[model samples]
Target chain A: MEGPKIYGELFGLPITQTLVNTWIIMAMILVVCAILTKNMQKRPGKAQVIAETIVTVMDGLVGQTMGKDKMKFAPWMLALIMFLAFANTSGIYGLRSPTADLNCTVGLALMTFFMTQFYGLKSKGLGGFLKGFLEPMPFLLPINIIGEFANPVSLSFRLFGNMLGGGIIMALLYSALAGLYFFPVLIPVPFHFYFDIFSGLLQSFIFTMLSMVFISGAMD
Target chain B: MEGLDFIKACSAIGAGIAMIAGVGPGIGQGFAAGKGAEAVGRQPEAQSDIVRTMLLGAAVAETTGIYGLIVALILLFANPFY
Candidate 1:
């Protein structure tokens, strides 16, 4: 429904609940990463094993999706998935998912869009990248440009729309069931499972996978 | 004013109309599911992979429906015109 509430302002900028929640997610991620990597041993500890497994899984995923040559992008993809997974599922903790905000989703999608363009330019020289729009026929250049621009729009709206829809439905359900004492307790659990947990993780995976595809497609 | 009531009534109708976009994803995902079933039937061994890919594609197909829901929700709860 409405955007996140504005808690206050910092200097000239308005600080919203979304921003606060995002900062919390970031700090949590930072603390976990630090703790997980604090001790490196010849014989891996449980934490190290978990950390290594995550890394290798992410590495394998990126390799499979974007090819081994694009493995350098694994760290960025990993961070994107981690942030999105947490942000999308924050509703479980009774916090509004930051991904429900257009600004957050758009910002993340723009990062992916920029990465695609940057890698494209690097792989193909500036002239070559520019010339790509003219491929097969120069008449198709405008269509190609529009297609490229559509990527970020669709990407941002896809994530934002899903999370916001979930939030709105959950809110409406709670209010609708507020009159029934037991309905409120019994009804929302399955809805929460489908909307918050399943859709949240699925959307996060889709977003990251699409980012990899777009970036790799551009570079190739 | 009469104008204010008129706008509110129109906004409600607009929200209802926006939800018609759900038709696209419904049809698309149904077709995807049918195809997924066919694939799984053809290769029973690859059921897991087929189902996984189908779910992924179905989620993407759901974007337009979600967009429609968003517009309807915004119109009802966060009308910018208001």
Candidate 2:
């Protein structure tokens, strides 16, 4: 409904709810990882099983999306997906979802953009990477360059727009129901289910999937 | 006062107009879903893979609608004209 609240200023930079929410989400993720991975077991306990399942699923996803040889990217992709999932779902807890902020989404997208370019050059050498823009004809080089830059713009906007849109709709719905005669308890549940749960989860998955596609595309 | 009110009125209308972009994704996703169902019917064994691909494609197709939403929200909440 409105921009993230500015809490205070530090070193001439204003601290906003988005930044605070991001820090909290990051710390929560670290704590969860520590708890899940605390004990080592040959057979397995519940937490160990959960940790192994997450690792195996992410590794399989990276292999399926990128390639079997690119299994090295599994950790990075897993972190991206995990962070995104938390950021997007934070809305359900009354905290502003960090992905709803353009700055946060842009930062995430920039990481993907740089990784794509870095790995592209790393895998194909400078000459081949540069020559990629000239395919079909030299005249199409500018178009190709624009397309490369557009990836990050679209990626950031896609996540930001979806999360913000859902947040706005939820906010409007709650305010509308609050003005009604009866208690608006159960009325907003379906909306919460669709907007916060369904769309949030789907957008997070789509973001990570698109990132994987872009990085893999550059490499191959 | 009159000019500011006029701009706000126009932006409210423009926000409604921007949402016309939703029609494209609505139709595109419906077609995708229909085709996906047909594919599943033809090859029930690959239903999981087919549905997964369909959902991903539908999400991508929904981007234009999301773009339109961003434009409408900008006009409503972060209006440059304001």
Candidate 3:
């Protein structure tokens, strides 16, 4: 509600709870990946089966959203989705979701935006990409530029807003119910399910899907 | 000079006003749900696909409402002026 608390400073940079949570998420992901891939077997074990299923699902998602030709983007998409899924659901673990912080969401959105522009330029030459802005009429260039700039802003705010809203509601609910001993224990479960689990996963999926659409749209 | 009470009052009003953005998403999602129901009624076999698409589009449509909630929360808990 009051934004992520700054715990301390490291060197010159301010360290916030969000940063710590992000690092934790990253470490967890790394450890899981390491454990899953530590041993290779011709006849797959349960861990290998789980890992393969995840890979196949991600591959299918990328292929469906960005086209089969863009399967190269599957790894990045998988990483983004996995990070977002964990970040958005970190509230269940009593950690402030990094996505709730404007800085985090903006950074993620900027990555998508830059990727969109970079791939656009790569697929279409600079001249062609520039020419895209002048389509139908050259006078529409300013409008097109504004629309292009709005992408990252809306993308960031959409995610930040949803995550922060959930955090605020959960905080307020806990405070309001604290007076009732049993209510505090029992009432927040459904709210937690909807906000932290359902909305978190759905938002992560939406963000990944939108990123795919934007990048692929640029390339195509 | 305005006292702390005035600031609190204004923050409360601001939070209330910010929540007005929810109206747009409420109507939009309801419209989507109705259309989805119509489609499913017409082709019951494709209900799963229709529901999936409807949910995705509704989630996108929810952006504005979430934006409103953010503004309201900021006003209530993170009032910059305070």
Predicted structure with the largest DockQ when compared to the true one: 1
Please name the candidate that would achieve the greatest TM-score relative to the true structure. 2
TM-score of model number 1 = 0.95
Q: Which structure is stronger by DockQ: 1 or 3?
A: 1
| Model 2 C-alpha lDDT per residue in residues B1-82, reported as the tens digit of each score | 6999999999999999999999999999999999999999999999999998998899888888999999999998899986
Q: Candidate 2, what DockQ?
A: 0.85
Per-residue lDDT of model 1, residues A10-43, tens digit only: 8989999999999999998899999999879999
Better of 1 and 2 by DockQ: 1
How well does chain B match by TM-score in each candidate? 0.95, 0.96, 0.94
Interface RMSD of 1: 0.7
Clashes of each: 0, 0, 0
What's each prediction's TM-score?
A: 0.95, 0.97, 0.94
lDDT of 3 by residue, A5-35 (tens): 8999999999999999999999989999999
Sort by TM-score, top down from the best: 2, 1, 3
Candidate 3, DockQ to 2 decimals?
Answer: 0.86
Candidate closer to the true structure by DockQ (higher is better), 2 or 3: 3
Instruction: Give stretches of model 2 more than 4 Å off.
Output: none
Off by over 4 Å in 3: A181-184, B1-4
> Going through the candidates in order, what fraction of the true interface contacts does each contain?
0.94, 0.76, 0.94
What would you estimate as the lDDT of candidate 3?
0.91
* Number of the top-ranking candidate, with lDDT as the measure: 1
